[model samples]
Target: MATTTGTEAPELTGLPLLGSLFDLKNDSLGTFLRARRDHGDVVRISAGPPGIRTTVYGVFSAAGAQQVLAGESANFRKDNAFYQEVRESFGNGLLTSQDEDYLRQRRLVQPLFTRRRVDGYAAAVAAETTTLIEEWRDAGAGTVDVLQAMTRLSLRAVARILFGTDVDAAVEIVEDNFPDVGAYVLRRGYSPLNVPRDWPTPGNRRAATVHRALYEVCDRIIAERRSSGGAPGDGQDLLTLLVEAESAEDGSFDATELREQVLVFLLAGHETTATSLGFALHLLALHPEERKRAHEEVDRVLAGRTPGAGDLDALPYVTRVLKEAMRLFPAAPVIGRRAVEATVVGGVAIPAGADVIVAPWVTHRHPDYWEDAERFDPDRFTPEAEAARPRYAWFPFGGGPRACIGQHFSMLESVIALAMILQRHDLEAVDTVVPVAPAITLQAAGPARCRLTPRRP
Candidate 1:
């Protein structure tokens, strides 16, 4: 049993019956920010009406975030409604598994993401980036929707890395269908009430179609790979590695489990990295000085050559710029979990079985930890400055055992892509203001368009 303060956290006020339903649906990011601004670190926010009104305990402070995500993580289970929806859509992979299942999956998957192994994928990342750069140049120096471009770039890159020889068969299906799948996940994940997925509603039907297509492609690729009789760990790509992963006690993931893991990889691998790179470029476009600084670093580090794993440490300023962008627009803005038992967080008592969320969108900008919180300054990530803040203050990749497994892969991909792009062209924001909304991931609510000028010729 856990001790509590016996007092509940302050609640965000809402309308009659509907509570904060409309407010959340309209602008969830703003609502979370306001909750922390007006109601303090820990606030109770409710949505929907009486019976189905879903209220979550919003832990907004870095310390509170740490408590929920790290310190007392065992008490916060991923059995929340949002995760349930994710599991249904994505499958019971590492992202949605609980307890022993998650641990076993983690053990099997960990070897593939090791620093040395992940770094080996740099050549693949560089190759895809080169292709994107060529495409942009061929299109001429005009306004480009970076978010869209990066989304495609990341999907293709990950698909290539995952599918290898079968990249052609997998890339198009993932790129075309993921948006619908993500939209469906967001639609149901936050809803206080959802009809059964088999109900054949328009949303359900579309989601089912996309989900099936995505799964079939992955299954097909996996079958082909297995039929090829190539050893799992012996292959160059990630899917081969996943297929080869084995444990003494737990054995290996079966075919269905393989599809589930592939779905998760495709979702997290492309979407989050795309969000970071898109915003990093957009932010650079808006701030001339920062962009110039980044360009200088890129030029100095790569010296008119393609970026590789070795260049990551050499490009500190560019890395910081990406860090700042992630700080401002974390891909996974809000992470949810359910309190398994009564507990106290930041002096507020949360009852057992309560829905809980740790919002990086809010914690990254916590006034106490971040001065001039809304400003974009890469210097904030300098080692000395980062050490000055609490650990959880800027968790764009999340924290704890459940933290994103693709963290290193994402950073590596973002750094290489950003460096390569900056080396070729200078950017200007066509859509100066990139408003964001919380979907399955943090998405620019409108077009994140930018104009690029060739550095030479």
Candidate 2:
């Protein structure tokens, strides 16, 4: 097996406990980027304990990433240490599962998120965004946090399309529980022995309660759908598909598996889209000229009406802005895999059992790959511009066999959301500071306060 001998391994010099502890508590992407810049793309660090080596692979090139994701994937497995913490909240959902279980779950859930099915939800996305915009207008922008607003709008859209019923109440349940679950999963030294739910620790208790509440919500939704007898005529929501989906072997997902899948879509699908939209809006507000270009594109194609799925192709500029926003702050910023066996990535030997971190945050901003990597230039994603670049250099939804199943869903949702919003009101950033926070998803550190004004004729 390929191995990095003591002499061949990247030099490691940081104080083990201090660096590891600080990295665990602070921005992981920032820490990893700094090390990569200082020590080159392939850097090894001792993460606080013996035998626990962290390998950050700088995938600045498409070929390098393909090597890890496609060429030598068999040697890599989902990082169980990281995912075990997530399993506490997400269970063995597709996002956290590994091996055969993961493959099975992904196969069963893939059909529901197929491009054809996801496209059908465009109307729902536009309607939801329109409703929220009208409400925001009626309220007369004192100071609205667009992040929270987008979260609500995106959640409602997911609810309408995924469940076929407006489950706004359940959306509220999810919003409340999501942060605590994310915090619990991200905490360092996380283990079953650390703290029990009954302990006095606020975080522990909150985690337990949130987990219970999430299950209850999922149970209610499942029971309601089952009683309703599949989809109502003409109802093409995701839950309808899930209720009817059959496996290749003539089996269907059991209640437990169904619950997990539903929860996964409910959480992963909506949250990431909302975060991307929030960031897009913020960027549009900051760059008035770019925002004007987007508005002009929307005005021409949409012609002052709501956008449908067909409008997606015509609104290329709007889509570019969203793509660039995700490139800058990918919702799933960093993805890692533990080497099940020794492997070679980009011609570099990766030892067995090493954690291989592939950070889109670093890759997206790599000076070697993108021109003006730090700037917000949506034009970079235009057809002509995109062709000039390598494929794997930009993977907000990841790639390979495990690429995000809901990518088309997100793109459709963002296109509709952006087009609908631009058609109505023009937004401006408030003086308030918008911090960048990396949670289960990268979100505006705090509320994203913005000023909204109705566009004049």
Candidate 3:
């Protein structure tokens, strides 16, 4: 018995044949917003021949997001084209894993990110960020690319706390190949043709080479740790925890699964954290009053010392700034899921094979959920204001069972890094033009450059 999908969905008409392909590729944010503005919560944007029916249903409202993310998540699993595409470089890691296997892996990794473990990671985050600020001091008033600075700082933090290794070496490998993989993915995603990764095409070949190198990086790190009799940080960090704590053969991650977990941590943790912090610092750079307020809060909370994990609650304004920045520039702006069964989101009939997109950027800034939707106002996240909005309105870390495992870890890392930077320096925006580049992660398409000025003592 087929359940009839309720309410007719308004469709966004596009050019013949190409449909909305070019529009989505060139101006995804604009295209998504336009669909919402014109068609209400459930907007259908097709991308195929005139009547061929290869359509994508965009969920634009917070309630629509709730339908896909929380309301009926069981019917709409992560078995989608986006996950298939991401699995090319990183393999079937937790980022792309599903159902039973995913649950097993999640349970094994859950203990590694508990509050106690995350609190333990604070010292490494503070030390790495303080070192990064010191390097800016050594440069003596030189202009810096905030994104690059943040990438290195974040990668190092993950390496030391999670991998328990000398971060400089891993940082070099991560920096070299991550951008290559990301750019290749973005190009492939936007390309009209659907080329498989196994094909011998030049782009596929290049991506393969990069993924191989990335896998090798993971292999070497794991091999070294195992060869050392698995004495990883004396069994303190996640690497050691994963290796030593074997709940069951069916309950734990094996060698291959462990490698995928590392890649997930490295990319998901390192890239998203860097991107979010980059935007946070950039927002602070543009809004001096907010930055000054953040500084005051940090000063009051830390009292001239580095921010520890314990002080996360004390720095309410700093947390709000992060919350606002993520709302504006969500690291993973859009999350995709393919419906395993026929479903309706916001009263639109979604056939079984349809790809459903829940764009946080659109939902977060929806006029219905947000005031002055485009403005950078951290106060929108204050207790009273946030409590009034729909819970799904601002899910930077996503929602439901498949939410980012490192959400807590990322928050702690970002707050510590941002506060530490504010304690030592102030970022002044230099690049006036920051384009939005939709890729594996959303980042400043242009150079996220800023003037690094030391704070006056």
Query: Where does model 3 exceed 4 Å of error?
Result: 1-3, 49-53, 189-192, 231-233
Clashes in predicted model 1? 0
Error of 2 at 265 (Å): 0.6
RMSD per prediction, one decimal? 1.6, 2.7, 1.9
Q: Is candidate 2 or 3 superior in TM-score?
A: 3
The 0-to-1 C-alpha lDDT of every candidate, in the order given, reads 0.90, 0.75, 0.82
TM-score (C-alpha, index-matched) for candidate 1: 0.97
**Candidate 1 vs candidate 2: which has greater TM-score?**
1
Best by lDDT: 1
TM agreement with the true structure for every prediction = 0.97, 0.92, 0.95
Cα lDDT of model 2 by residue, 1-457, tens digit: 5444433446435664543545644656677677667766666655445444444444435666666666666666777566666765677888878788887777777777777777888888888888897887788765677788888888888877877764675787888887777777766323313555467787777677888998888777777777887755675777768877787653677778778887888878888999889889888988899999998998888778778888889988999999999998799887777777766665466677777767788888877778888898998897887888777788888788778889999999988998888887687887445767566677666777777778842
Name the runs in model 2 displaced over 4 angstroms. 1-7, 49-61, 188-202, 231-233, 248-250, 431-433
Superposed by TM-score, candidate 2 places the C-alpha of residue 81 at a distance from the truth, in angstroms, of 1.1
How does model 2 fare in lDDT?
0.75
Give the alpha carbon lDDT tens digit for every residue of 149-266 in model 3. 8888888899887677656656778888998988886665545467667889987788788888888877887777777766445557677777765675555666787788888888
The TM-score-based order of candidates, best leading, equals 1, 3, 2
